[model samples]
Target: MPAGPPGKHNAQAGGLGSVPALGRPERRAESLAVAGLQPFSSVDFPGRLAAVVFLQGCPWRCGYCHNPGLQSRGPGAGPRWPELRDWLARRVGRLDGVVFSGGEPSLDPALPDVLDELRAMGYALGLHTAGLAPRRLAVLLPRLDWVGLDIKAAPTDAALHDRITGRRGSVRAVRESLALLRSGSVDFECRSTVHPAWFTDADVLRLVSELSSVPRHVLQLARLPDASGTARAPIAWPSAALLAEARVIRPDLQLRAA
Candidate 1:
């Protein structure tokens, strides 16, 4: 499009200049600091060690959103990545890996630089995305070691799912991403959050059946929390009737109810 405030290259007149077209990197060997880092995590991705990165900003306004503070993109906060990079620089031998999570880390224009930096740091990479921008997955999937994709709902009807996400195009994006990643190189899993209002037994079965052929899909029964958002109350789990339906439908289904 126009220009990138003269960081490295100048866009040619009337050309798509310097944006690097989704997956390509125009420059590396320079600034590649990750925005945020959580020293260690147990629940981020199954068994591997990871650091939670809080990349700022997101496009959707799902009511079930847990990190509301990360929704808004604020003014420059003095490059958290540089310091993160320095921190990682010392832990090259100590930790397992890094996870680039966010308000939607993929949406951040600087993700490539940060990911580029992480790669240089010699740590394995993992990601958690809501599948907002499916096309970008083609680019980002190659960079990650594992992916935990939050699948909102069935692609058959957008309105039902959109009511929760508050975004019309999210279902389409999520579906497209699932289809595209069915045969990709990265190790990935698809999970749907089950809350009282958003899902019914039939709905869960439909969701699982639709994704029956996907390589590594997982169904995560999201534990609904109390008003404080910190303390969780143990409500009755998903119905055994629904569980039976899923078992009957997808023999290879991977489900965990919490």
Candidate 2:
């Protein structure tokens, strides 16, 4: 996502920390720039039958980010929110929940209203986020039923974390968001995607150590989708050694790689 217009903190805010949504007004539902939609997904929201709404616009430029096309703001490739609402209405008993994935869903100010509508329809709400905006997450926390937070790096390792995210100071905001999740009643899971090219075994160990207090943690090996081109050499999954090591740090740690 481009830098926030002046007065709203951008990369320069306090020099290299995740920028917060400061002084921004609430966005309207019509303002939702949806990038894509998966009308049904059994995996996105855990055990529930659900749909995935991919929102547009993300400030970070993580190299391993799969949805690079969703990085920009404005009208996305999917139907607008009004159309989505109509679709959701048709899904009443067929779906148990809706998961909002991103381009950092928290960046959309109209999310609170979106949550209200989902609640009225009696659908559980789940959010997948990098937690770019702590203030926004703090407000949305109460409305969330499940959250999947991407822990890109250890919070204190600002330089490396920023390097991984291609956005300076993002760790600060993630840490704040994690703290809010911990202090709230919401059920959340923290996960990090690892590619040997960017992360070492020691890095994973350090991350797990830092996340020891979280109730659930997942470690997923990055995989290029089928459309990404089969000509490239097959990538190795995260080593079982690494998973074993992570489990040592947190016995309950879950491995999301296959």
Query: Which candidate number would show the highest lDDT if scored against the true structure?
Result: 2
Which pairs in model 1 have colliding backbones? none
What total of clashing residue pairs does each candidate reach?
Answer: 0, 5
| Candidate 2 C-alpha error for residue 226, in Å | 12
Candidate 2, 1-258: lDDT as tens digits: 111121221111222113232232235776777776776778777789987787888889987676777788877666667657766766789999988887889888878888887788899999999988999998888888999899988767788789888987789999889999999899988888766667777887888899999978877666544475632222554567777877888999876641
- lDDT agreement with native, every candidate: 0.63, 0.75
Task: Name the regions of candidate 1 deviating beyond 4 angstroms.
Answer: 1-36, 75-79, 223-234, 251-258
Tens-digit lDDT track of model 1 for 76-177 = 222344445565556677777877666676666666666767787687888788888887777887777887787778667587679878877568888777
Which TM-score value belongs to model 2? Answer: 0.84
Model 1 residue 150 lDDT score: 77
The all-Cα superposition gives candidate 2 an RMSD in Å to the true structure of: 10.1
Note each model's CA RMSD in angstroms: 10.2, 10.1
